[model samples]
Target: MSGLDNVIAAETRLSEVDGANGRLVICGHSLDDLAGNVPYEDVLALLLPDLLGPNPQAIRADLGQARVVAFRQLAHLDAELAALPVTEALRALMARLPDGEDRETALLQIAAPAVFVPALVRRQAGQGAIAPDPARAHAADMLAMLTGADPGAEAVRALDTYLVTVSDHGLNASTFTARVVASTRAGYASAVVAALGALKGPLHGGAPGPVLDMLDAIGTPANAADWIDAALVRGERLMGFGHRVYRVRDPRADALKGALRRLGAAGGMDAGRLALAEAIERDALTALRARKPDRVLETNVEFFTALLLEALGFPRDAFTGVFAAGRVGGWVAHAHEQIETGRLIRPQSRYVGPQPAGRAA
Candidate 1:
């Protein structure tokens, strides 16, 4: 009963995570099919066919305008946002959006992270936020806004792959949070703010940034095995080496690793870091299997996510916010689905505490 391990909470047509098979299906396409092949805006359309329609070009234009709207809405709050953590700033700004289930509100909800996250990043560093260009693609605009420069084609593709790879997974903790709020008839902004709160937990979206810390501690490829062995002996949880759902290596890991490789091939990334990470992954898998034969511990998406985002110039603290930028589309779609068809999500809990004097045991 604890952790809702086998609980069937909600029915969704959005996406599924087959942990046993290490497969991820989004809409009707496999993750492998969509990640590198399909753009992020196309994935948004796939998730929100009824709301966003099937035309990716139109969705891109609408989403671009949504980004501008979100940017303008948050422009005056720059100083306040700079003082909060990135995820908290995102949640705070999301709360300020007008609450409604209307199409425009949903688009704004989805665009909130794309605009607010980078703006907060800039504000935190004592720089003015860059405005979103209504002409560029969503992922490109996120990169450009963060760095205040035009992002390269390969960097844009790398970011798009990250976004597409993470767009949705069935009933994740944060997605479930969004659905719960949506089922209460709350609008997209409210639901997405709730989801952002859930994602701030260490067990969920917060795990990715620590992966860079792990890599830093390891220092070199030659130190990987010994460092991993010592960390395992010390009972320290290795960031990015395991997942709660997957019994096999996470499918997103491969997708991101492929993106990182492509970025390096384009001379946008340092080859040394990639080599060190691969060595660490090989050693970690071997050590995990040897140390815990009864459990399945394999490389998950966070390992390569840290590398890809770092290569794309995101600081470690911004990892989860970037994750939200990709996942907001799925959150909005899931919220819409719950609003359209689902009832209020209120499950009963058994009373296990000491009963009052008059209460039955």
Candidate 2:
């Protein structure tokens, strides 16, 4: 099969996706333990142990400084970057970093999107880019950079949950892409850029924005079941209703949902919107179970991702770039791991074409 099902790719100490049980483990921590409970800098320390150093506080400060540096480095490109799509602009900014295996390059790769995604958001809106606050938490700094104001504590916490939840997720398509490039001895920046290309594909990082579309089409709680049923009847996918890896439910979904609830509790999100999303999730789950009982279709991360990012004031078009801001740490960590312990990830394929001269058949 072209899917490479059951294939054992590179081994690492980064994260594991247990599809059968619907669990995610990062480094030594479970998804439940990390998301919303820990800061993103703590997760980065777990992923990039060698580079982030031993102190969690220092890692936070260094990453904050890195964002400042990345913003300065890409200042010259802001006019041009604002013209491109956010993800492409992010990739372009990432491409500008000096390629190296050193801590400086890795920090830039991690920080570039944090800086650039917000800059691009503001610049595209004809507003000036806000400079990074070197002392702020990574997620808070991102929110601050986006709005040019200190964000609320709850908003910062919610964004931190999101970044930590997606910081790593096993050998996913983009992480695998990063590994493939890293196996060739490519530096962190190159691997990260390549990974961003993989993530830009619709199948991988494009689902979240569409989840909002699905919700918008459903219109209200009363319309969810019929809309979902119709989509399924038409052989159309119900976005955010299923996952390729998780058999039960995506753990990240619950994590994000929790964050959304917390944000709603803090008066950061519209309560009616939250209720609408929850109703749709319940309806989608019931409809999927009835239509495809043999298949395990459950609420995935993209469902709540759409709601949460919307509440955070991000447009649907920039969803994937926000995802990259979270996943970049994993890409860099995987690249570093590949360089330290893995061989070139060259896979073989069986040929199924015509034999030459009938020598063998």
Candidate 3:
């Protein structure tokens, strides 16, 4: 019998991952090229293709409008889960989005998180959700909505950098799940919802929040090395180091780390937290390399993820929901790709159990 591993059909057009070389290309542009240069909405247009119908500026305008419209729905959902954790409350809200038949309608539904999560976080803390400013950029509006204060040029730049860097990656588990669902002729909203579900898993998008938790548990930089070492001895997977794909380090990590440094320089952060996190990264990387010489364990995206979110004033609990804000664009694009290809996704499973005994029922 053919091995199960050989049966999974790999699709190239959907996304391309060069794991060994630490390279990622989404659509046609290299991730590094797009992350710092383009606005999140422009990248979204690129991913959506002709379906967004050739107007980058207009598409962005529409997305901004959608975010405002979606806020009312988010407020309603937030009230229902006022006591629940932000991620769970957000998930429940997302699941309730009305299914749409066409791609554009679907795009609106997926774009809701960029507005909703931030709004819910503010409202839950007894702060008012700031209204979206159509005149401002998407990342700027999101930050403003969360904090009820307009972000400075540096803070807005940092948020834009973070959103752009994470806009897409080649067929990560969530995006792959999205493509699979879309291939089945499910609408875009369905595909995005499926992706969100996958992203919530601990091994994937759920990781970044734990970096803060780890820092808190360790208490200070003086305890960082010992805490990490103890966790290693106990066989715990350190939350922010190592990756399933990158053998060296996640390229996005440095980009976000640089953004954090810039934000810190602009006086937007708690200097103590920033210093402690940097020390942890250095000590953790050193310990990992020394302990596991055979394996290429290194800092992944989640390391700087904590710093960036902290600098942005996002509480630790809201990290994954913020991730969904960046990833929804990719999810929408991949869904469009799968639907355009017009193929059904079906993969075979292998049976490992002993052959059934001769029928004796």
Q: Rank the candidates by lDDT, best first.
A: 1, 2, 3
lDDT of each: 0.91, 0.90, 0.79
Which candidate model has the greater lDDT, 1 or 2? 1
For model 3, residues 103-157, the per-residue Cα lDDT tens digits are 5565676568877788778877987677787667788888988888888988988
The count of residue-pair clashes in candidate 1 stands at 0
Measured with C-alpha atoms, the lDDT of residue 232 in candidate 1 is 92
Residues 1-361, model 2: lDDT tens digits: 6587788987889999999999999998899998999888899899988887757799988988898788887558746666999888888878888998999989888988988888888888888888888999899999998888889999999999999999999888999999999999889989999999999999999889988888788888998888888888999988887888899999999999999999999999999899999999998889889989999999999889999999998888889999999999999999999999999988888898888895964
Candidate 3, TM-score vs. the true structure?
0.91
Per-residue C-alpha lDDT of model 1 across residues 218-248, encoded as one tens digit per residue: 9999999999999999998888987889999
Candidate 3 residue pairs in backbone clash: none
TM-score of each: 0.98, 0.97, 0.91
In model 1, what are the clashing residue pairs, if there are any? Answer: none
Candidate 2 residue-wise lDDT at 271: 95
